[model samples]
Target: MEKAKVYYTDMHTTFRENLLQKIQRLMKSAGIETIDFDKKYVAIKIHFGEPGNLAYLRPNYAKAVADVIKSLGGRPFLTDCNTLYVGRRKNALDHIDAAYENGYSPFSTGCHVIIADGLKGTDEAYVPVPDGEYVKEAKIGRAIMDADIVISLNHFKGHEATGFGGAIKNLGMGCGSRAGKMEMHNAGKPYVKESKCIGCGSCIRNCAHSAITITDKKASINTDKCLGCGRCVGVCPVDAIKTLNDESNDILNCKMAEYTAAVIRNRPNFHISLVIDVSPYCDCHAENDTPIVPDVGMFASFDPVALDRACADAVNNQPVTPGSRLDISEHIHGDHFCDSHPETNWKTQLSHAEKLGLGTQEYELIKI
Candidate 1:
């Protein structure tokens, strides 16, 4: 198989040619023009920073992509699935507000913002992959499933569980509905730490299945009733409900790979990863820590797995900055996320993604 072409450009421009222009050129060079966008519904999957997190990709980049799609006669809309964690993006209403608050309004991006899943994050369509590790089928947002083309505009950053969140993370975990997120997160029940439970009834209120009930001045989860949706974990005032710790990161990464494969199987797809911010954590967090390294610019590709692997390699090759999160390591040639977060092995996602026929780890980085 020929190496996947991943095009990149360094962040070097003053006033005339900005990152947005560079992205447009990069996409074209990466062969995104091959897709026929005429009258097609293009879903531009992106993370609208969770209200307070400042590390998400800029709206200007989204606007550029939307413009390109529109120029090709495609009807584009910025979309993201509702988050599972109790945060600003837990539902469509709140998620849309957060997107607008973060400056991704339809006026700005030249497209409407649609939370892929409907109001409660339960509106989903099952996409069968036939062969999968943890999930034989992916529960994707109905609107996302309905789109004619899929494009991921991802903010590549370190992830606490998966080592790093890149294009695959953006497509798999990012596109899954809140309930779908629960499936990828844990195979066992979510345990409620009674000590931290305030019995505020928030969990009981948010749980659609009434899985949580307060009793004896403490909140307890009815494991029998619980579907392991993980809603209680987010709504708890105290850090009470939590997923089991025994689950391996490799398992989680593999599940994510399968879910992502379900989204793009037999569909026209494109991906772009922005390596700016370089935060030590995912943008899903309420706050972003200082960057572990300097901004490396942007990359675009037709193959998401190849694009992600290329970006991870680029980040690993750069010298770690002093006073940053990765200040300890003298050696940075291997996986940077693993060195930064020793407990995580990111290769699980890459290798599993390749096995699932999503894409390959081998890629040729063509500098644009």
Candidate 2:
């Protein structure tokens, strides 16, 4: 495959052109206007940081993207699916609240914020992945699938499980509904936490597969019968049901690539990643440690895989921040993300994505 074009611009800004304007310029240079967005619903998929994590992208950046979309005759909305974990973003209501708390309100982003997966994290579209080896069908958030165009506005950073979080991470794992996330993160079915079970038959009632049963004032999940749809995890009022999270990191990356393919397949999609913050863990954590590397810059591309590769290369090229996590750790791999997260190989995601014809890892970085 030929090298894809990945446009880039550093964070350095002059008084005349602020960071927001710079991002807009970057997007334009990246050919965002090429997409015919006439009165179309465009989903700007992003991670509205966990309530207490301050590293997520700012609302101003979202506004810049949304404004560009609107100027191109599109209706844009900032969106993300509810997280599978028990956190501020576990459900739509709480997820919206978390977005709002993190300053992602419409008033700030110049667009509405939609929890893609709906109230209970159950509203989903089972998109078939024809080339998938691990996931035959990806359960994506309904709101995301309903959009006419998809845009990933990602906060590129370190990830404990995936080495780094970029366009693929933002679109694949980020777009997955609760069940889809469960599928990516778990190799096995969910189980009931006996201590948390209140004898509430909520799980039993909601289990379409009859995988759950209440006994002795406690809930138990039958692994043989469970489909791992994660509905029981959502309906359990007491949060008794929990996923095993047994999927190996490599398999998790492959599943994530398949999920991303399911998401952007046969759709007009674009990707932008800001390689700042460079946190050593996912934004799903309520707290973020200091950035492991100095702020790099912003990147945009039509090819998600190429975009991620570019961003990763940029981060790896930067010097490690003093006193940060990467500074103290042993840099055995000579790669920033791998040095930060020894357990994960981010290349698996890009290679699998390329193998599935999502996009090529080879890219031409066009600096603005």
Candidate 3:
């Protein structure tokens, strides 16, 4: 197979031709104009950071992408699935509020914000993938599934469980409905640790299947009835509910790859990954630690797998910065994510993505 083209640009420009110009160039080189966007619903998936975390991609970057979509006559909207963790982005209402608070409003990005899954995260369309290893079908958010095009604007960064959250993570894990996310994260029903339960009934209220029962000053989950949406786990006030670790990290990454394929199935898609603000953890965390590396530039590609592979290679080749979280860790390696989190193997995401026919890991990095 021919290597997919992954266009890149470094942080080497003055105010005259800044990163935004580079972004435009990168997208053009990557063939962003190839898609027919007239009258299309373009869903630009992105992570709006938890309110206090400052490491997420700036809304200006989103505006650049939104402008490109608008220029093509696409009706673009910035979107993300409601997070499974208890935080400001747990539901559509609060998620939009956090997005607006963080400057991702229509005025800033030239598009409205929509929680891909509806109000309580139950709105989904089951997409069948007959060749899937872990999941035969993926429950994607309704708005996301219904869109004519899917564009991922990812803030490439380190992750605790997935090694790194790049394009595959963005689509697979990011695009899944609350229940689909649960399926990718765990292979079984989620449980409530009664000892940690505050009996606040937050989990009960969030469970779409009504699997959680609260009485006697505690909450207990009925496994038989639970669909394992994982909303309960995120809604608990005290972190009482938890998804059991039934799947291996390798399997989880593979499942994520399959789910990602389900998301882009039969749809025109584009991807862009920003390697700046290389946070040591996912933006889901309220607090972002120091960056592990210097600001690498932006990457754009039609092939998400190749885009991620190129980004990971770029980060691996760079020298680690001193006084960062990566520097503090005694055991070091060429790969920053592995050096920071030794237990995770990030390659599983790419290898599995290839297996699912999402795209090839083999890529040619074309510098802009």
Candidate 4:
């Protein structure tokens, strides 16, 4: 495969042109307009920051992308699947509320926010992964799968598990339904936390495999009967049930790459990642630490893999911010993501993505 084109723009803005305008220019330069969006449903996939974690991309960037889609005669909506873990975005109602509270309302982004998987994170489309190894069929959120086009508006940052959250991570793990996410993150079934369970019987009712049973007003999952659908993880009103998260980092990255492949396989997709507020952890966490590095900039590409590669390279080339997490860490693995997360090797995701025919890791960076 030839080198993929990844366009980039610095964070330097003057009086006339601000960062927002720069993003618009960057997307156009990256060929976002080339995609025919006439009356099609465009899913602008984004992470509406978990309330209190301010590292997430602002609604302004989403609006810029949505506005461009609208101009091309497309119907666009900002969308994301419910998170598998316990958080404000675990269900559609709370997810929407959190999104609105975080200022991603239709009033802010010029489009509606749809929780991709339905009310309880169970609604999904079983998408077959082409040439998949770890995953055969990916359980993706129904709304995201129903879209005519997928545009990932990603916030690039370091991650604890996958090493970094970029285009691949955004589309793969971010788009999975509750069951799908569990499959990628864990090798074992979920166990109920008795301290948090209120004996609501919500989990027992939602489990189709008859894997859950209640004893003494608490829930217990029968691991033998459990299929690990993760529905019980979402239905617990008090956030009692939890995933085992026993997958190794390499396996986790590979599974995420497969999931990413499942998401964009046969769809028209575009990717953009903003490398600002380079947090050491994901926005899923309620607290965000200081940036590990100074703000890099915005990047866009038709190829998600190349886009991520370019962003990761850009961060690796930059000087670490003083007093940040990167500065505090003593180990230098020659890669910032790996250095920040010593247990993880970020290359696994890109290499696996390349093997899956997603996009080449080699990219021609065009600075605009």
Cα lDDT tens digits for candidate 4, 1-368 = 99999999999999999988899999999998899999999999999999999999999999999999999999999999999887899899999999999999999899999999999999999999868888888999999999999999999999999999999999999999998999999988999889998999999999898998889999899999998888888777888998888999999999999999888888799999999999999999998999988999899999999999999999999898899988989997878888898999889999999999999999999999
Expressed as tens digits, the lDDT of each residue in 1-368 for candidate 1 is 67888999999986888878888989889888889999999999999998889999889989999999999899999999988767898778889999999999999999999998887777888889789968877889989999999999999989989999999899999988766787888788887778878778888888889877788878887889987765566455565777764568888899999999989988899999999999989998989888888889899999888999999988987877678777875545366798778888888999999999888888998998
Candidate 3: list runs displaced more than 4 Å: 195-219, 225-241
Q: Which portions of model 1 miss their true places by more than 4 Å?
A: 14-16, 190-246, 328-334
**For model 3, what is the alpha-carbon lDDT of residue 220?**
91
TM-scores of the candidates are: 0.88, 0.98, 0.92, 0.97
Candidate lDDT (C-alpha), each = 0.87, 0.92, 0.88, 0.93
The CA root-mean-square deviation of candidate 2, after full C-alpha superposition on the true structure, stands at 0.9
Clashes within 3 Å, all models in order: 0, 0, 0, 0
Candidate 4 stretches greater than 4 Å from native: none
lDDT per residue for candidate 2 within 1-368, as digits (tens), equals: 89999999998989899999999999999999999999999999999999889898989999999999999999999999988888899899999999999999989888999999899888999999988999999999999999999999999999999999999999999999988899999988888889888996888888898887777998888888987888987777777788878989999999999999999999899999999898999999999999999999999999999999998888888998999999999767999889998989999999999999998989999999
Clashes of 1: 0
lDDT winner between candidates 1 and 2? 2
Per-residue error (Å), model 1, residue 175: 0.9
Model 4: per-residue Cα lDDT at residue 347: 90
lDDT of 2 at 295: 93
- The residue pairs found clashing in candidate 1 are none
Candidate No. with top TM-score: 2
